[model samples]
Target: MEREKIKRIVSKHRHEKAAILAILHEIQEEDKQLETESLNYIAQLLKIPVANVYGLATFYSAFSLGKKGDTKIRVCSGISCHINGADEVNEALKSKFNLEMGETTWDEKFSLEKVHCLGLCSIGPNVAFNLVTYPKLNKERIETIIEILHKRTGDSK
Candidate 1:
């Protein structure tokens, strides 16, 4: 992330003490993940310890220190989702992309992750692609979603 961008985000909050999380969220949203350099710059701008910034970044599941793929897929592993066959959904995705949970593809196009819940239990076995939630997942449905994402991202495979 550029220093100017980080400065702009910090300036948006006027470097307020309470806006730390917001600042980080904006940075992460832009960068897809928090870089070490960005973390250092944020700490300096906020006049806080680097360790503090790092701690907060690591503590939140929303923040990722590693590079993320353009498409992020999160499968719900909550009780309802599990009972509804989330495991099967997960296995299908894993087989489709050759991805394990928390792993990004070598092409940097897709990342697969398991989340505790997506808060949409009425339609269990939910899957979130990027930020869009898909309800009532099955292997076939998941395949369709992946195909759509691939098309949108210009992935032939």
Candidate 2:
């Protein structure tokens, strides 16, 4: 989770002595893909090119250059979810997070990402955080989730 630690981890594999792609792959696996900070740190620690890291990160959507959220809220915008009030669900989430699509909440507790499908069209209007899915969601339910999230974060910190 820390840059210096990532650098140190990557340092265990020397570029001249190790496989470049293997190092990048390993870094990506450990950090859920190349975060820009991790990428730069990895490059700096190993004396590799930043562009190489950037190139690899960009080459794969599995990579991310920025920070991810503690809770990733993915709302399916696929056709089935669309007809079943995905728009309303999307709006409610946006309003609740005070964010548009593809944005993370200011507190960094939640990030809203839209996907084409969640593979559950039969359960349309799907909303999920990590792995917990809520089907047939409404505004009221959305509000409840927000409240619960606030409380949970409050208690943890």
What TM-score goes with each of the models? 0.92, 0.71
Q: Tens digits of per-residue lDDT for model 1 on 38-57?
A: 99999999899999999999
The residue-level lDDT of candidate 2 at 9 comes to 62
Give the worst 10-residue stretch by lDDT in candidate 2.
Answer: 60-69
Best prediction by TM-score:
1
Clashing pairs in 1: none
Candidate 2: where are CA atoms >4 Å away? 1-4, 7-35, 43-49, 155-157
- Tell me the whole-model lDDT of each prediction, alpha carbons only: 0.88, 0.72
Residue-level error in angstroms, candidate 2, position 153:
2.0
Q: On residues 57-123, what C-alpha lDDT tens digit does candidate 2 reach at each position? A: 7776545555446777888889988997888888988887787776666656777888878898897
